[model samples]
Target: MRDLLAITKAIADESRLRAVGLLDGRELCLCQIVEVLGLAPSTVSRHMAILGQARLVESRKQGRWAYFRLTEDDAPAEVHDALAMVLASLKRDKQAKADQKTLKAVLKIEPEELCRRQSDCKC
Candidate 1:
């Protein structure tokens, strides 16, 4: 019951759901997701945390960067089904389409460059 509740709560928000959609089949660095969603890095981190708790996403830290991807292959059936539902329902959503378009450009920028740009850093 707790797992179900967490999964439902994790995907309850539009931002989180969109984040999941963006991660359907690709791994993304935190900065890339921040760029696509136009949200603060901290905010996106919180969203990722929730999704992680729900077993909907997985993360790996390499140095200072964190990469996230949708949980698959080993995720519970419910998690997979929920994600499928989200992807199917939002396939034609205007916002989702816009995000994907923006994501193409976002993906072109290397992760380190994206982080530097986000932080307005010269390094």
Candidate 2:
């Protein structure tokens, strides 16, 4: 029950939902997500932390970089269900499509260069 409540709250915000949408089909550097969403690094980090708490995403640190991806098949059934709903909803969303376009461009930039472009990047 607590986990479900956390998942519900984690996905309640537009910014967070957009962040999740950006993460679909690939793992991304934290800075890459920040670029796609055009949000402050700190804000995106907090949003990701919430998603992590809900077990909707998993993250790891590699050197000075952090990368995030959707949880894998071993996740709870509720998590898989929630992810399916979000991904399906995003499929028809104009904003999500736009973000995907932006993400494509962002992915072209080297992660180090991308992180350098973010004013609030801690790495």
Q: Which candidate's TM-score is highest?
A: 2
Clashing pairs in 1: none
TM-score of each: 0.93, 0.98
- Against the correct fold, how does model 1 do in TM-score? 0.93
Please report, in order, the local distance difference test score of every candidate based on alpha carbons: 0.88, 0.94
lDDT of 2 by residue, 1-123 (tens): 998999999999999999899989899999999998889999999999999999999999999999999999988999999999999999999999999999989989999998889998977
Q: In model 2, where is the ten-residue run with the lowest total lDDT?
A: 114-123
96 Cα displacement, candidate 2 (Å): 0.2
Model 1 bad stretches (over 4 Å) = 120-123
Give per-residue lDDT, candidate 1, residue 50: 98
Candidate 2 regions with alpha-carbon error over 4 angstroms:
none
Query: What is the clash tally of candidate 1?
Result: 0
Best by lDDT: 2
